[model samples]
Target chain A: MSFADVNIQFLEAAKYTLGLFFLTLLIAIPLGVVICACAMSRFRPVKWLANTFIWIIRGTPLMLQVIVVMYGPGLIFDVPMKNRFLAALIAFAINYAAYFAEIYRGGIMAMPKGQYEAGKVLGMSKASVNGLVIFPQVVKKITPAMGNEVITLVKDTSIANIIALPEIILTAKNIVATYAIIWPLFYTGVFYLLMSGVLTLFFKWLEKRTNYYKA
Target chain B: MAFYQVNNVYKNFGDVKVLKGINLELDEGQVLAIIGSSGSGKTTLLRCLNFLEIPDKADIYLKGENIFSIDNTDSAAASNADESNISEVENGKNIQTDSEKNQPTHAKKAKPEKISKEMRKLIDSKRGHFGMVFQSFNLFPHFNVLKNVTLAAKLKYDAHAPKGFARWSKEAKAARKQAMQEINEKAVALLERVGLGEKLNSYPCELSGGQQQRVAIARALILQPDILCFDEPTSALDPELTREVLKVIRDLKKDGHTMIVVTHEMQFAKKVADKVIFMADGIVEEEGTPQQVFEHPVSEKTKAFLAESEKSIDEE
Candidate 1:
């Protein structure tokens, strides 16, 4: 193969990695907050339901959840599932939402209860407590957890290839299988390491910004 | 109606009885002080006001209406079962949301419309009408002073309590606007009152303990609440810093605002207290004018308390 073809292949793989990283984030942050509300809701059933979902998600492999979400409707109900990209998105959204929910819950619960009562006597309601009193505090509390999840998500998205959704690792593996070369596989690590490193730096910056909450 | 009254309140956690037949009362324009040693249920008594934890048995009144009704042991379990069963039986009859489980309990007791609605109406009235401060300043760590002060205006004062009520109407817009204005003007004024006018934009950590407590005071007072409860607001401060906070409380008293303060400052209590209550073992052991309680203690507990607190301050 020409050197130019190998360069193009690397570019193609970079596009896939970048796409998955952005897509997961675009879906995860808000969805994680929603999951957090469900998990830590004042309402009992909602909390129980959210806890059950997290328990199931954490207990099982992400690989299995990916397959089930991607293929379950078609396999179980004898109906065609949506496009592979959409299935992958749903699987990723749901799986990460559960993980994010736990991060949020942990962050929120870690805060002193006095903060909440303080919010209350401040005449803030539960929702206001969440938005004004709690959410920002939780954000500070969860930055590390969120940072970890986001980094892990960068690597986990490669599971898209199980159903042939064509992410970075898939791009690398396919090229290596055909060309009798392992450079693409090793090149895949560059994308992950770079993304993870950037996220780590971003989180450190966020932590520095949130240091006012140290009290 | 006195703004609030807690009559014959009882609270027990497992085998431990925290508050036994406690009585507390606050009127529209009075400063009632609850002073005691630690673990005396002073905090628990404060918690009961908002139903954060209900009394095991009691009659609580707000605005002359009965707001708290304790359960008889026989009916407590029965009522709990009936509510759960009613929902379980009705679960198949209609759509259900995940949050239905924590819906206000009054809905299950009387007519779905009458009693529960009245109960909610009563609870909603309490919102914004009263405010509390803690021993620890408990300021929102993430937000600046202005946003923290503005929270009641944007969220709770304008928002209804005992939520899940139907939406307010177009006619209610004026009330909403009025509430908004009250929250804004009053919060800003309160910040000024607490000497935090310039620091409105500052975050909690940027301030000293005295400054943070001042901000917390503004955050509490913004709603124009009928009563402001300060739970040992100065305990966390040094003696010099405590003087700054006491000045603010003194100003509030000068303005004729009612208060229920749990304080360790005997001098402040003696000076500003219209009535001083000595709480011990979750109940009032002694209560009278500050002079009567402080200078002439009636109970052994009160005598011991005055002796200990007075000695420590002088030693320093």
Candidate 2:
């Protein structure tokens, strides 16, 4: 393949990689928030279930999780798994939500207990206390950690190759093997580096935007 | 009739009885100053009144309306109140009246009475009746002076506004705008009145402790609470800063705002409070006019606390 052809192919694969990244985040971030609420729930069984889910996801490797999520149901229940991309997407979302939920819990717990009391005395309901008073501060707090997870997600998209999904790395590997060349593989690193760099800048801007609270 | 009444208020935290059967009443414009050392349950008492620390057993009436009930009907709670007082369920759902008073039942039966929607609305509305200022001046660190003051007012308006008034209808939008304009005006006037007009745009962290406490005062006042509770509002500040906050509170007294101030500043209490309650060991040891409590305390606990507090002030 020509260098131009190689670049175009990599770009097409990059689109898939980026799609995976955004979609995983779309599902994971909100699910992480729900899990965070559950982790802090007053009901014992709910909190236990949420904590167990987080523990299992965090304790296992992403590669192992991807394999299990993709094939476990099909193998165990006599149902063949279809939609390779959807399986990988679900695996990524579940894995990331655990980490994101941990970060959220930490950020929320770091806030002084008095903040809730103050909100209550101001006549805010329990739900509004979390929504209006607590969540904003938690977002500011978890941004740096969140940025780290997001950047990791950008790189970890390559893990989809475990399921033989043609993400950026797999595409580059195929190109190198066909053309008997090695440059495309190195070029794949450039896309990830650039994406991570942009995300770092975005998160820095976010931190500055929310730097209203101080000692 | 009293504007606010707290009857037999009791609170327990894991077997530690923090507040034991405290009863108090406040007429309109009456300023009650609660003075006590740490762990005296003065703060807990204030928290219970606002339902911040849900009392194990209590009856709080605002303008003769049962503030805890969901329907705002005194009769719903009034009928339940006579039901053996066997410490009914926390949510008032199971308030069982025991007819077998003489037959000592091994277990108490709970009669399910779901609190009505109207009563929930009433309870929420009545929450605006008492505003509390904490010792740490717990201002929302994320919001600026203006936002802090305006937020509660905005919330109160949203909670009580006509349905769909928050929507996009022209009439709804106009009414919302008018309501917001009024709230904003009230907030501004309150901040200005608290002498924080210049700091409206400043974040809580950017302001001094005294300034932050003043902002908190302004935020509470925006709710137009019938009574304001100050839980050592100046405790975090230096004497100089404390003076500034106390001055603002003193002005509130002059304006005839009903207040319950918990403080270590005996001089401020003597100057500002209409009724001084000296609490010790989870109960009111002595309560009377400032002169009666400070000059001639009836209880030994009150006299000792006063002397020790005076010594600390002297050392300072």
Candidate 3:
């Protein structure tokens, strides 16, 4: 495919593509935090709820999840999830939240128990100490893990094509269908490759800034 | 505490009872050393006085008030005082209504919930009016020495932080700063006290075991706690390092910081201990002044344990 052809298709899908990446981020960041808190909760009910959600999401295929979102709401409640793109976005958001939650939980648990005891001994309330002291350390410890999830989120944006939402991969597919060529599909990799490359570099900056959190 | 006491304390981890019925007391200014064999539960007993180990149905007190007793008197008093104040305010009292006065206010109901949460936090912080110095020197590895010492001061003293020239009071900002400075100075006096004045800025990873213990000693002493508990503060060091840390404790004795030390240094305990507790299998086998217990141990367990320790030391 010519550069002109590829650019137009890329631009066409760019609207849906941008919506998925940022929208999923908005949903996942908060849901991920809650899911992480649930997993860490001492109550068995909370832990089980969080773990079961994570297990089911992780166990199933993303394509199946997209199909479920597209039709399941309409089937169960007679509320049509009118836009397949919105269905695609919701499915991807929930799926990646479960993944990001694990990343967060892993980071928090790996912190030394001594830090919490030190906080207590120094007269810190459990909530204040964890927020001001432990959370910063957790953020630092989890930066690499979080970075991996974020970069993967960028690549996984391609999965929106499963619900035919016209993200970069589907944009490339439509170009192939319109013009009988495969080059645009190959060039789609470049968008992901460049975006992922940029994300990896950004995390390196985050890691350096957070180097103060020692074990 | 008006005076610190450990009375008839007993503890066991599963079947292995570590402390049998034990009774002891320290006046506000005296230092007491507990010397015993490893696994003798000296640390366990020291922790009990602080209610660190909640006995499986036993009593521990500070200033003679049952600390482990869960009657909720402190919290209840707080809530009652608050309720009376609210009722008084509702009936027209002089208290400035919280800034949200214009709202019909969920807060009269919410205030009790909020205050109780705050009260629980306050009570927990109050527990550490006495400080702990671990053998490993559990300094916040993330912060500098200055930040570690000032941390409590910063959080406790500063009520409302603002912005601009007074965005935060430099003094308020330096509540921690001043605590760090005074801590640094006292720590220096303590380092000079234990002779580590030159090593103030040093991190724990960079210091020798003896030096780290000295820093731990300085950290605990900086608070001027009613009683300072040592969990084998020098036991981790080599002989040379052990002497270095011991010299610091000796200086603490001179300075009059009340201390409950868990030690294996028999000679050190013999020299300075006003009371000696010989613990075996968690019960106090026998306890008295170092003179009474060391020179003429009454229990066979105490006698054999001391003799065996002396023999081992002599061989070493």
Candidate 4:
């Protein structure tokens, strides 16, 4: 195959990889906050249920979780597996949301009690206290941790290949088989590197912006 | 009626009784300084007044309005208070209750009432009556000095704005913009009063401890509270910084602001306080004019505390 053909194939596959990454993040970030709230809920049953879900998702490997999400339903329930990409997206989002929830909880719990008291004494309502005073500080704290997960997610998108989602790695491997060349496989590293490098810079800028406030 | 009155307030943390049947009354334009060693519940008392820590039983009146009252019918808590009192006496800590002597009997028989949502909302609304300055100067770190001072005021204004008009209406938007301008002006004036006129854009992290505390003071003052309570306002500052914050506080006193200051600065207490209270082991050991408390303390506990404080000052 010509370099142009390989480049075209890799670029098309990169679209899938980028879509999965962005969509998973778009869903997971907000879902993580919801899960974190449930985990931290004053209601005992809700807290336990959220914590158990987080525990199972986090304790297992992502590849296994994805496989289970993709195949387990059809195998056990005898339901036909429909959208492979959607299944992978669901698995990735659920897995990452669990991790993000813990990071969020850690950030929030690490906050000084004085922050809440400061808001209370200011006559702010409870919702306003958390929304204005607490969450902004929590975001600053969770940024570095969230950034780490995001970079990991960039590479983890390749795991969708197991479900034959035809992402970048799968396309590169197909080229390796057809053209009997290996560099296309190695060339895929450039895409991951560029994406992660940009993310690293973005996170660094975010950290710097939030550096205006110190805990 | 007193401008602010804390009647028969009691607070407990599990088995530990923090404030036991404390009663304090302050009139308008008066500064009451509460002096005590650590764990004497002075800070807890201030927290109770600010509603940061809800009292188990308290009748808090602001401008003769009963802003917060909880009747703890939990007989268990009353007995727990008594037990803690015995433990305090056994520890050889004086259990003086000159003001609280009659409160226990009254509190034990009261019916237990939970802090209902309505009551909490009421207390939250009434919280504007008291402004609190914490020892740590808990200014919102994410906000600049001016933003920190103006934030609560703006929130209050937005909450109370007329709801008849749509938020997007020109009249409503104009009113909001004008209100914001006024809040900013008031904040700038208060910051300037606290000697932070030039640091209005600076974040809390960029300022020194003294400057942060002053910002906290400005933040509190902008709310126009009926009373300002300082919980060891200068305890976290260096001596020089302490003097700077105390100077602002002294200036506020001269401006006729009523304040309750829980502090360890004996000299400042003596000089600035209209009334001095000495608390020990969750009770007021002595309360009087500065001359009476500092110069002629009646209780042995107060005398020992003052002497120790003076010796520490001398050594420093």
Best candidate according to lDDT: 4
Query: What TM-scores result for chain A when each predicted structure is judged separately against the true chain A?
Result: 0.89, 0.95, 0.94, 0.97
Best DockQ among the predictions, by candidate number:
4
- Residues B1-316, candidate 3: write the lDDT tens digits: 4477666666555455666767777766566778767777777776555544433324445676654432122343466565654321122122222221111122223221112333344346456657777776777655655455556655654433554667466665666466556645654565566666666566556667787677666666655666777777777789999898887777777777677878888888888767777777777777788899899888998888788887854585
Query: Which scores higher on TM-score, 3 or 4?
Result: 4
What is the C-alpha lDDT profile of model 1 across B233-312, one tens digit per residue?
99999998999999999989989898888888888999988998999997899999998998899899999888888685
TM-score of 3: 0.78
lDDT for residue B295 in candidate 2, whole number 0-100? 97
iRMS per model, in Å, is 4.9, 10.1, 10.7, 8.1
User: What are the clashing pairs of model 3?
Assistant: B18-B282, B19-B282, B20-B282, B20-B283, B162-B167, B163-B167, B164-B167, B190-B193, B191-B195, B191-B196
Enumerate the chain B TM-scores of all models. 0.76, 0.82, 0.72, 0.86
True contacts kept of 2: 0.66
**What are the per-residue Cα lDDT tens digits for candidate 1 across A1-215?**
55567657767766756776687778877887888788867677998998898899889988888789778998999876778777877778788888887877777667787876676555555676767666777777788888888888888888888988777778778878988888767877776788789989988998898886565
Model 1, B315: alpha-carbon shift in Å? 11
- TM for every model, in the order presented, reads 0.78, 0.86, 0.78, 0.90
User: Given candidate 1, what's the lDDT at residue B169?
Assistant: 58
Clashing pairs in 1: none
Residue A100 lDDT (model 4): 96
Q: Distance (Å) between predicted and true CA of A176, model 4? A: 2.8
What does candidate 4's lDDT look like per residue over A98-201, in tens digits? 99999999998888878888888888877788899989999999999999999999999999999999999999989899889999999999989999999999
After superposition of all CA atoms, the RMSD between model 2 and the true structure is 6.5
Worst 10 residues of 3 chain B by lDDT: B99-108
In angstroms, the error of model 4 at B290 is 0.8
**Top candidate (TM-score):** 4
Candidate 3: tens digits of C-alpha lDDT, residues A1-215: 67986888787777787778889989988899999889877577998999999999999998899889998989999998889778988998899889989988887767665566556555666676778777877788888888888888888778878777878898888878988987888888887888789889999999997665345
